[model samples]
Target: MLKEFRDFIAKGNVLDMAIGVVMASAFTSIVNSMVSDIIMPFVEAALGSTDFTSIVVKVAGITFRIGNFMQAVFTFLIISIVLFFVMKAVASLKNRFTHEEEEEEEEVDPTEALLTEIRDLLREEKQSASK
Candidate 1:
């Protein structure tokens, strides 16, 4: 059981997941900042009192802060957009490395390979004969 646990922990998939979780948490903080600190402030400045969290309404003894809901929705939107671009960039980088490896491993026709080997051998013989 201990050995199995150790093997699971040592797997690259598990390690990769751990690293991804750490990176995602860091990315979330940055996106949250961009939405709350930067974008929301700009949006509020333009709207001139659009702080939905502070706005509340009471109807039939039930109170609802619709503004908070709006704010949450807007924040969600910003986070989604930011994450979309971040993931897109990460995918492009991954594709670049994978594409490079694929190109390196590109299959060469056997006939072409054989012909090239023959050509090299012929060249070597020609050089030796000239010498």
Candidate 2:
């Protein structure tokens, strides 16, 4: 059981997930800051409100915080757009690196290729001679 647990923890998928969680937590803070500090000011200015979160509605014996919900939705949209661009950049970089690796793998030494063909021909000739 201890060995199994160790193996599980040592697996690449587990490590990658742990790293992703940590990075996501950090990324969330950055996105949250961008939304609140940078984007929210512009949004509030456009809406003619000093504080978006303060905008609320009152109903019959009830209170509704529509502004807060809207703020959350706006933050979600900004984060989604930022994440979309980030993921696209990462995918392009990954593809570029993989493409370079494939190109390197495809490049064969001309001398080695010639030697290989010669070896194959010699083998065929030897087989015919034996026959």
Candidate 3:
């Protein structure tokens, strides 16, 4: 129904997901530009090739662009590393803000507790006898 559809659209998770998708697309473009424009040039210079994508291999009449594949893999690695760090930082900040860390409680052995109580009782009895 219309009401159900409207409710689904109005959900906070749905809205967050929509925004995340938009942001991710924008971020992807920025990363792609950085790889192709900035990083690739340096890599190409080191390899002594101006156009790395143009590098190819021909075998049995089949041409394979190994350069393009390498570039794609490099770009993917950069994006993955960047996203990993970003997500780690975000998670740390979220944890810091959202919850107080639980202090670890030391476990007391029942035997030790019983011994402590007996020691206290003995100390009290000695005091009473001394009085």
Candidate 4:
């Protein structure tokens, strides 16, 4: 069990996943800051001081903060857009740094290789015979 665990860690998939998780966590903080600090202020200004969360109608004495819901929706949208652009930039940089390696030659089947050799030998024999 110890050996199996060691092998699993050695495979590097876990390490890659850890790195990805860390990067995502860091990216999330940045997006959250942008949404709360940068974008939300503009949205608030556009929306004005009229608190949407307070404007509610009671159907069966049920209170619904529509303004709060709208705020949540806008926050989600801004975060999504910011993350999208960040991911796009990351992809562009990754593409720029990591070039597409030349494809390796496909492995010829052993039987096919043998048959090719036989065909070449027969062609040579036929050529010699014709001469």
Candidate 5:
């Protein structure tokens, strides 16, 4: 059981997943910074200093931070678009690497073809004799 566990942990897929998780976490920070620090400022300037993060509403007893929700939505959209393009590029690269041009079928060996013809001719002769 210990050896099996060790083998599982040692697999390339597990290591790759770990690395991916770490890189994704780092990438998330970069994306978040880009959205909050860069994009939001430009957006705020265009919208006359409107802070979407602070926009909220209260109804009955519940407080709804709609601005934060909008920010989150924008963040998701940016991330999704970036990921979509990245995946598209990776897919194209994978297709390029894995694509195999079809090759014309090789001619059958003469001896094999002759034997097949002879077998067919014998079968035909047998069928005729039986008839």
Candidate 6:
């Protein structure tokens, strides 16, 4: 059981997933900061300095914070768009590196060639003997 656990932990996919989780967490923080600190200020400026997070509505004793919800929705949209472009750029870079214009030369396997030669020789011997 211990060996199995160790093998599972040592797998490449598990390590990659762990790294991805860490990177995504850091990316989330950067996106959150970009939305709240930079973008929201500009939006606020354009909207006459209205505090979107403070706008709320109360109905039948239930308080609804529509402004905060809108802010969150905008933040999510920005983050998703940023991530989409980032992923697209990364995919393009990866393709650029992995794609080659020059044609790759195909090499025949020596063992397979030898096996075919042996089979041909045996067939020739059998046909000659039959004749």
lDDT of each: 0.86, 0.86, 0.81, 0.78, 0.81, 0.82
Tens digit per residue, CA lDDT, model 2, 1-131: 99999999999999999999999899888877877788768877887764458868999968899889977777678778877887899999999999999999999999999999999999999999999
Tell me the deviation in Å of residue 35 in model 2: 4.0
Best by TM-score: 2
For model 5, the local distance difference test gives 0.81
lDDT of 1 by residue, 1-131 (tens): 99999999999999999999999899778888887787777777888854669878999999998879987887788778877888899999999999999998897889999999999999999999999
The weakest ten consecutive residues by lDDT in model 3 span 98-107
RMSD (Å) of each candidate, 1 decimal: 6.7, 3.5, 8.1, 7.4, 6.5, 6.1
Q: Looking at model 1, which ten-residue stretch has the lowest summed lDDT? A: 43-52
Between the candidate structures 2 and 4, which one is better when assessed by TM-score? 2
TM per candidate = 0.63, 0.72, 0.55, 0.58, 0.54, 0.62
What TM-score quantifies how close candidate 5 is to the native fold? 0.54
Cα error, candidate 5, residue 122 (Å): 35
Which runs of model 3 end up more than 4 angstroms from their true locations? 36-45, 49-51, 88-131
lDDT, candidate 3, 1-131, per-residue tens: 99999999999999999999999899888877876787667777886764548779999999999989976776677678767877899999988765544322355679999999999999999999999
lDDT sort, best first: 1, 2, 6, 3, 5, 4
* Cα TM-score of candidate 2: 0.72
Winner on lDDT (4 vs 6): 6
Instruction: Give the per-residue Cα lDDT of candidate 3 at 54.
Output: 78
What RMSD does model 5 have?
6.5
Q: Can you tell me which runs of candidate 4 are displaced by over 4 Å?
A: 49-57, 93-131
